[model samples]
Target: MKLSKNFTNPLAANNPVIVQILGICSALAVTVKLEPALVMGLSVTFVTAFSNLIMSLLRNGLPSRIRIIVQLVVIATLVIVVDQFLRAYMYDVSKQLSVYVGLIITNCIVMGRVEAFALGNKPWDSFVDGVANGIGYALILVIVAFFRELFGSGTLFGFDVLARFGYTNNALMLFPPMALIIIGCIIWVHRSINKDLQEK
Candidate 1:
């Protein structure tokens, strides 16, 4: 049951993005298009899962004073790997993502999980928590990107989805503030459904 909660909680009830408001910067920067948002989400998921696993494995022996430094090293190394991989095979998307890929190292969601859950949990449990939180973040990115790309550019993954139907692209949707607006709407809907999250 605990493992189930570890894996399931972040999907909605305890999402890193909307609920905890952890990684909103990337959501705003990359959600301008679906492809980059998808790539960014996957990149974060990989880094989070492995960083948590590594940190959890090392937690017992890690000196408390240097733990934050060590966590940054681990996360940075993983982010570099993802960045290089994207540059190699997905150059266009990598270019679109720009420095935001490297910025994942500083992402609150990644380091927060390492400090909060991975340090205390078993390796397997920590890995589950990381994956869950990463996916939760990714899910929001995808939703926001979907609406942004559809209305902002009248395209999804560069395909003309609505242009033929007399849809005039809304330039405003492509901006970062639009992403925040979409996220706000999502939070409102989420809280309405999950009354437990609502303030008394």
Candidate 2:
């Protein structure tokens, strides 16, 4: 079904992170720890899904010349709401996330979906596409964060799993470069398995 493809494609076959590589900066920035990555993922999914729905609803009436401006306004409003909620309810995590949470407004994944899919599709379809792409981005962030947090901090979600086994954590895994390396490895493995992605 078309709806199913919109939801499933971004999970693997058409992953925005590994395939399109649209939002790699956030993937690298927030993956040093699992908690932040999880929060970031949820926030992005929420924003993208709602933003797409909003854009799709407005598509017919939106003036072509000011569509980008309107899109930013809608996105900014959602980002602010999410940011404020984080600051109020999850102060410590909000502190850890810092401006990155607010930066969701500018994430290409969000903007791209709004422009490309939402502007031309029905509300339900655009919503599905937004969620799919957000999950695609989030999936990679979580994967990178899992490795980085486990090896880098000797813990999973701060539980100290590696320390239990008497293994030392690798400091390199705490760095941003390591996130990039892990993402690169994921892309390599994905492309290897799905040879259709290989360049002709």
Candidate 3:
């Protein structure tokens, strides 16, 4: 797979969140705030990209029977490195992210992309696939976070963005359920605008 082909596909045609519906957990859990959501997104992107790169390099040596084990090892190593870097340089954000950071290990999107695309591709192509999926996932989270922070809290990134107009916040937006609704609405709107995306 070519890097450009791999990268663009994830962002649109094969979006992990919208198309594959993977990584919805983080999209709901850590996206109440913009900054945290952004951090989580970047972290996941970094892990997925590098892990896929490593897996692509090792694809030939790994046995089919133990492929899951190989994938787990690669994912775990990448997550740990990301965790340590966050703890060292951005303790506060790291603390906010908490268990969710560790939960990256189980995020189906990361593993799915690695197994589905990375395993057979070259390192560069795999890396692009990771980035594309990460971005695809991030798009939903960021959009949801933008609205959740906006309406649920009357702020953007925790700063008051519409206070002067006396727009009080709705507490419901901060919860995980609201994120689902926001995401659903996003999908509806996206599909409505792009009729080609409509269900058959």
> Clashing residue pairs in candidate 3, if any?
none
Number of the top-ranking candidate, with lDDT as the measure: 1
lDDT assessment of candidate 1: 0.96
**Candidate 2: minimum summed lDDT over ten consecutive residues — where?**
20-29
Stretches of candidate 3 above 4 Å error? none
TM per prediction: 0.99, 0.98, 0.94
Give one digit per residue, the lDDT tens place, for model 1 in 138-184: 99999999999999999999999999899999999998999999999
Residue 8 in model 1: lDDT: 89
- Candidate order (TM-score): 1, 2, 3
Residue 162, model 3: lDDT of 80
Deviation in angstroms for 165 in model 2?
A: 1.1
Candidate 3 per-residue lDDT, tens place, 1-200, comes to 46577778777766788767889898899988888888898988998899888999999988999999989988999999999999999898899889999999999988998888789888888888888788888877888899988888788877788876799878898889999998888877767766887779
C-alpha lDDT (0 to 100) for residue 148 of candidate 3? 88
- Two-way lDDT contest, 1 vs 3, winner: 1
